[model samples]
Target chain A: MPAPLSRRHLLARGTTAGFFIVAGQWLWLTPREAEARVFDPQVLSPEQCKALSILGDALVPGAADAGIAAYIDLQLQAGDESLLIGKYLGVDTPAQTEFYRAAADNVISLAGDKNSMQTFATNMASDSLSGWAGPPASYVLFVLRADALDVTYGTPEGFERLGIPYMAQIKPDKPW
Target chain B: MVSKNCDVIIVGAGAAGLTLAARLAEGGKSVSILEAGPERKLGDLVSSQIWARKLKWSEPAVSESGNHKIGHAFNAGTGTGGSALHHYGVWLRMHEGDFSLSSDHGVGLDWPLNYEELAPYYDQVQAEIGLSGDSVKERWRPQGAPYPMPPLPLFAQSRVLAKGFAKTGRHTSPLPLAINSEPYQGRPACHYDGWCDSGCSIGALGNPLAVWLPRALAAGALLEHNARVSRVIRDANNTQRVESVEYLQDGERKTMQADRIIVAAFAVQSVRILLSSATEQHSAPGNHSDKLGRYLMTHPAGTIFGLFDEETYPHQGVTAGQLLSHDDYDEKDAAGGFGSSQWMIGHAIKPHDLLGYGTNRPDIFGAELEPWLKRASRHLGNMTVVCEDIPLPENRITLSDRLDRDGIAHAHAHHDLEPSAAARCTQRMSEGADILRAAGASEVWAGPRIGQHHMGGAVMGSNPEESVTDAFGRVHDTDNLYVAGPALFPSSGAVNPTFTITALASRQADHILSIN
Candidate 1:
């Protein structure tokens, strides 16, 4: 829960890699960028998209690279709220859609509107979110937490691609 | 009426049935096994780490209703080799103490056969099917022939967890799996790809397709799939002797007569068949003991899932599990809060392994599902705690009043953990998680209550007053009618049930031969 760097420090240390978009498809490197820069949305306002991207970037080293932003946006637009997000966070409360909705609103409040999205995220990290409680934390923390989960868990990037080998613990040898 | 007869009418071709059929055919007995499942090819049995979701009991299918469903949606095996075609083949011998746990230590009821008494039979089955394992390192493994082949290699998860056990001053070793580590009895060595739940297509996994069934077929055994046995028919005047077996074949009612019969159709359904048959025939003769559908046991599993800073291919090599701690398998210890325990099996999880996801609460479905899946691929390390489920009358299998197409009521299997059983599983599992954490995993968490191995309903014992079948698995009231499979387990040990099922089957085969 105690993150090492404060918001200003994080921004100072954070490095942004420019989108090397190829053709019209808008090739994405991080899930965070996929939300910030691209994602088809008929439901989410542009401000909502901006807030989701800002929140994702602070969760992992390169969530934007993973296209997570585009993923969540698509889910919201499609009205598929049974994301099991509540289940994963250990919350038994139903209507996770409501929870996400409240959290997103709170995140935007802390983040601010449209053009001020980046400043708002920087502000929440340093000020308003310092001792943030309940639903908003659940939302911001959960989204980043899951993105961190994805980058680490079942993907090749998490296991095989990470260059970790399954150590041969048992001595598979001739039976005596 | 003209008699419909066959050389030998065997009931249920799951593990015991298939093994006996193969042996009988080799012995020159004309045999036909009646199984109620579609014909499954090796291709059909292939599946994900969680194999049950893919396999279904085709014959006498069960319809469950209760707070705790047996989740048998695909629990029972159908097709030629029966469950063996899809079994993980985790061959383990019951300890000498396992035989008389109740009488010896004042805990659960004792099995009629002792470890020494069952030893030869376990040995026979192992040799017949070529077991691959290392009982010596197990420290607590019972006296027996050494495995024909070496133990399978433990993946990084098992290896790391073994280190944790060492650190915690507990013991962990390479699990004595039935899977082949090297070629034994003409079967090829395992590829270490960790695909045991889906039936092993390569024959390296020691499933029936790779072992006994093939030999049984070579010995001239005939397997009739889609033949759901509904009733064990006996002449009303001579109820002790079975006259024929009634079942559904090709959507038509049919019966096959034989000199003797063996019912090995798994635990729950087997009991349903007996009770359903008695609805018209004999007032449920075994019901005299009032234990027909009692003492149901499943290795109700509790699991611990953890994340590691290190990379462990939590998915590679015989995923059902590969490290074991059987020191606590003794009955007295189990009756105590210590609980019965085994180490060799933990859930083998892919990044998206369903069980693993339950451990760490995070988004599963909806938007975040994909990211969690990718993260699970690398940082996951997990283990499970397996314990014996105490039999309660409530946790039983009974024929549903509503009949199926064959006129046999669907068997309703109702199972739930007694408080003691649930607690027992929880305590042992927490101990396991502590061990994994010590192994240097970055994060550690626990999964939900799971039903993996199964048991009970038609338990065997010496007294007709207390149990349904006699020591040799013969129904106390009906001499010629027999039953096998986990259905006869008085109490499921922390150990896996397949080995005991096969050993008991061999014991019954010998008894049948003698009586005939």
Candidate 2:
């Protein structure tokens, strides 16, 4: 038998690796690694993932690199067990998948020739995008921005980046 | 269907239910608690805000409507400890004037009992589960015994925020909390890591998992997790008594018989269970007067954020804040608004999550976001304004047409803040911003108003025609049915409701024991 994993070792591993399906097998990998490895998303389509990555990165720099799309995709597939902040914003888990899908579709529909992504984000924040459809653009922006922050600055590593102490009494086994 | 019998049956394993279970079981009555959520242990409470979402209400979604909706998904909780597990331990007592809202001010419903009647229970609960605070500093506090432990030391953030109160000529006190300041009753002292919102893993915080669950188990009270109660079944022969409770567990429908029943499932779910108990021969146990789910209330609350010049280290204390200002608490009919209000200052906060600085400002993003977040982490100071919610008949919990997979109807909450209450909240938030500016904040902003603590769905009152339950939380028109927790509160005071919820359950336990 392999050596038993100590509590410290398990915590260390947990902080970095989240459960993800890679190549028809369940494996522990960071969201960034999962994104780099092109893990199949169970809920969001490839096009939807691309849109989410672009919009999320525009909302918070480094969000795409932090794997915001993979993170949100995993949460959406979790159904009632989803840890997405949208749950607290009155969007139940059953509705979250559709909310994100529609929001991403609207983002995709925004003609690139009409405005830059940053300009689109600015309009989205103000609810001023002329042809924007689906759930209120400002509300979607808020939720997506919150999601980006969660993926980027919501963990111990993220705390270190911001110069704040994690100070966890019981560290999370899964970052999300 | 499997069936079990107990002397007393409680519908929830929250603060109120566990308190009753511990007390009643210790009094030699066989007790069984049915919790709708899964079991939770101390080790299960992780420190990440994202992970903490597991502790919140998840399934059988409670639909909400109207302006200023109750925010049920955010406010309510699931699992063993219920909402109390993730609560920020801001234990506060309702003022004497709060009990007499209708009698004194000709507005809202009045409590069946007054402050003096509930004072001893508050004192008892404080002693049982050690509270830390300087009562002498809380001059607005109603008559009660002093806190058991000295107040937790204030950090730099509170020191800076207290200066703002001083400059504004408002008195501030150590916020009374149910967290241990030092080693108390075998629990260690709080590490002041500011993860209270994520559920405290240590025994320092007086969550049900830390305080009442052990006592209840030791006293022979059996707890059933994932037992979603459908309704209370009235006896076929004796219509006035609730003989058995029907529930779903592990994909099986089951029933449990008990001599007495108490619905302690927080505010909304408790009322939902009772509302589901309606029969063709009789109205719901407390709905004879069409008042079972009426008078729903939630504190109209908002937070004011400021960017300070000094190194505040905003994440150095508890999430509930370090200092409190009740300077404007007593005068309900004050110039601007109708009800009482208080300020919880210097909250230990994070850069992410719902209430975090990063999420609060959706305007700044891309290259600008990270730099701002880093700065706010060090300099942000925030305080929440909690204002009393005027209980209205229209603000209620009703059965929604939507059904879950189990065929049980979902609960729907509709709440619109009264104009006067909204006005009061607006007035206080403006004042809070001014106070922050007075305290030398370089910049100040306020978050949107949201509902905080919930109360008053199955309210307790002197008249059965006017209320759902009597003073002892006994459901009117029923011999052995009761409602506990914030559901028994007739008015939503500005104060946090957990302390009062525990005290009311303590009183109900004593009353039930005496009758037995």
**lDDT values of the candidates?**
0.64, 0.91
* lDDT of candidate 2 over A91-171, digit per residue (tens): 988899999999889888983632378888888878888887789999999999999999889988889999999999987
Please, what is the TM-score per model?
0.73, 0.97
Mind sharing the TM-score for model 1? 0.73
Interface root-mean-square deviation (Å) of every model:
12.4, 0.7
Superposed by TM-score, candidate 1 places the C-alpha of residue B468 at a distance from the truth, in angstroms, of 1.4
Task: Summarize candidate 1's per-residue lDDT along B1-516 as a digit string, tens digits.
Answer: 436465567787778887777766766677888877766666554333323323444333466555445555335666666666656667777667666657764655767767888888888888767766677787888888877777777777677677888898877656766777778778778776655655776777767667767777888878888788888777766877677888888878888887767788888778887887775536674776578887776777767777777766666767667877776777435553634667654446644334445224642433444455456656677777767665566677877886755566777777777676677777777787778778886667776676766688898887788788988888888767788888898877777778888888888777765654
Sliding window of 10 residues with minimal summed lDDT for model 2 chain B: B1-10
Candidate No. with top TM-score:
2
Shift of residue B497 alpha carbon in model 2, Å:
0.4
* Clashing residue pairs in candidate 2 (N, C-alpha, C atoms within 3 angstroms): none
- What would the per-residue lDDT of candidate 2 be over residues B1-516, giving only the tens digit for each residue? 324498999999999999999999999999999999999999988899999999999888999998989889888999899999999999999999999999899999999999999999999999999999999999999988899999999999889989889998999999999999999999999999999999999989999999999999999999999999999999877888889999999999999999999999999999999989988888888999999889999999999999999989998999999999999899999999889999999999999999999999888998888899988999989999999999999999999999999999999999999999999999999999999998889999999999998898999999989999999999988899999999988898899999999999999999999994
Clashes of each: 42, 0
